[model samples]
Target: MQEIFSAILGDQLGPFGPLILMGTLGAVLILFTLPVLLKKKQDPLDRLRDQIKTSKDVANGKAPARLRYDNQKGARLEKYSAFLEPQDEEEYSAAQLKMIQAGYRSKNAVRMFHFAQFAMGLGALALGLIYALLKSAQQDMSPKSLVLTVLLPGVIGYMAPKYWVTRRIEARKEEIVNGFPDSLDLMLVCVEAGQSLDQAIIRVAVEIRAGFPALADEYEIVSHEIKAGKDKSVVLKDMAERCGVPDVASFVTVLIQSQQFGTSIADALRIYAAEMRDKRVMRAEEAANKLPTKMTLATMMLTVPPLLIILIGPSVYDIYTLLNETNF
Candidate 1:
């Protein structure tokens, strides 16, 4: 038993063993502590509840009307509120701005994305370091080579998250765009069925919830804005701006103008939906036309080099054999 314990201790405390133990402990500590720290810092509901309490106190003349929360999250909330503030200098409450900003937006998910990026970068750095250490310990490596090996992986890791984020954003935008015409068609049907514009938006939002959650989410934001007493035009415009899609923006502008001019909303929506469908058809045809070009490029990349190698290799070997025979 004594010998066994001594062997175990010797293995653990061998050369560079302490370093391994320290690294493991540090990693475990970070994993255990980071969530606790982030959770403590990120409880928005607590801040919101505090804000409500402060508002009640101020309204009852029990406390001075001054800002209470002073964290980064609070500051971000304030900035978002300022951005959402109506330009007419009306007595618009900050609550409305907060609601608008929070409506259908995943604050934690955005933060988690950034966190994921950081973790990826750190992982890459660790991988690079491990590679460098292993190479240096196992083989005679120069300092420059070690540095290059270590730094290259870290750099790749840093850029990977940015690339992933960009791809996700593009994919989400495409999904929203693809779902727009259908949502518009549903709205048109609802309007023709005698629902008001707001009701139509709500009905369409509900209808699209299963198939296109992203579009449904945007419409839900519009519904929230309307419920918050924002004007229909403003809500629609905000939806367009938030979506950042040209077709949706144009549709919103057209709807606003039609409403202002007493034009038929259903007719305008139907026309827009028809136009979008036509555009989608054109895009499909364009993609189909490009398929041959894409295929040609792919074939050149994947097939041509191998074909050249196979065709040239036997001839080159034959020529070499003939030249050797002549020399003999």
Candidate 2:
């Protein structure tokens, strides 16, 4: 065990071991991130649509070898999805909804998340053990510190994937909230141009890709559902739930009311768009108003010490010099 730890920490295997470890890690990171970096930013719905199309091609025996391999990986992930998910129907459905809101609507996404959590936990535990072993050989550390070094990282690693997913959900919501009004404006324009609500939505989805891809993608899904003969209110409600945003839910509620009451849909959208823009401006102003408080600590850390030294440093220096002269 000591020898293994030494080799892992590069004491026995020497510099070459660390070099190899870093190289392997770099390669793994590159492999994981390269495809993501290379692909143009696309909406999740659009990506899913493409994935569905690819699956259809494979079913028809027209997919390439690469696509076949991709499909196999997806299937393999799906097999493990049940392990991450609860067996209880109610709890599983809730967890699934949370995953969807986090832009993880792919069937295998939760499985992949669980896999990542396990991998990270094991890796952290291994690294922590290696660290503890190496340090114990070189110094007399306390048992408490050793235990903490090993267990803390293991716990954090296990939780990291879930934390990251939560952050993704928050970021997705923020993006949707920020871009929603512009999308509404575009939809309003289309509606005023004599397009039906469904047609207007499709147009807005196409037009808003550059500015707000996520919202545009949701709109695209709405269009597809409508075309598939789903009730607008039901589909829009689904979108609101999937997004998990109060603003979107309220907007959908407005649309449903307009439809139910046979009100002027275009006028309703125009008025709602104005309200959204105002709300966005208010949010911005609120953030701006809080900037000074947020900056206070940083300002003190950077500026206060220098000001104190400038004010009192010279007097202390003078006193030291005088006392030295008097031999006090």
Which candidate comes out best when scored by lDDT? 2
User: In each prediction, how many residue pairs overlap at the backbone (N, C-alpha, C within less than 3 A)?
Assistant: 0, 0
Please state the error at residue 243 of candidate 2 in Å.
Answer: 1.2
- Residue 21, model 2, lDDT: 51
What is candidate 1's lDDT per residue for 243-298, written digit by digit as tens?
A: 66788889989999998999888889889999999998998999999999889989
**Each prediction's whole-model lDDT (CA):** 0.72, 0.82
Residue ranges of candidate 2 with Cα displaced over 4 Å: 1-71, 77-82, 137-141, 325-328
Clash pairs, model 2 backbone: none
Report the Cα lDDT for candidate 1. 0.72
Summing lDDT over every window of 10 consecutive residues in candidate 1, give the lowest-scoring window.
Answer: 95-104
Question: 96-204, model 2: which lDDT tens digit per residue?
Answer: 7888888877766656777789779868866776686566556655758776866788798999998998998999999999999898988899999999999999999
